[model samples]
Target: MRNNLHSRKINFVQDFLRIQNEAVIRRFEDMLRQEQLKLAEADLSYPMSLEELNTVIDQAEKDDRNGRLTNADDLKKEIDNWE
Candidate 1:
């Protein structure tokens, strides 16, 4: 049952990707890149003290509330312009 569900999910993703235009696929890739960067940054900060981690989390919340974060699409455009 677990394998069947996994297979179905994989098939669904495959079908979705097959129908997406190049621009949509590129946008999806950019989103994945942004997520990868966030994960990498989190991983690098793994050795932080509890207080430091809490401070970092609080700062992230503040930035989010203040609209200080860049969206994946804008980041991708900025990166592309750098090339």
Candidate 2:
């Protein structure tokens, strides 16, 4: 019974793929790439101690309150000016 149910699920997926248009296939490919990127990033991450995490979060909040964040475009322009 389990094997029959699994085979039906696989057949449904195969049938769906067979009918998808080029645009739909491209969208699926893009989604798959995004998922792969997320998986790769997950593999590189390590857990931090609670104290260290809290310290980092506190520093971020402090920076936000102090208006210490730089705009991405402004930072890019500044770097270009350096060169």
Could you say which candidate leads in lDDT? 1
Q: TM-score of every model? A: 0.43, 0.40
Residue 31 error, candidate 1, Å: 34
Candidate 1, 1-83: lDDT as tens digits: 99999999999798866874888878778998999999999999888899998999999999999999999999999999994
lDDT of 2 by residue, 1-83 (tens): 99999999899789867975988888777988999999988966967789988999999999999999888999999999995
RMSD of 2: 12.4
Model 1: runs farther than 4 Å from truth?
1-46
lDDT of each: 0.91, 0.89
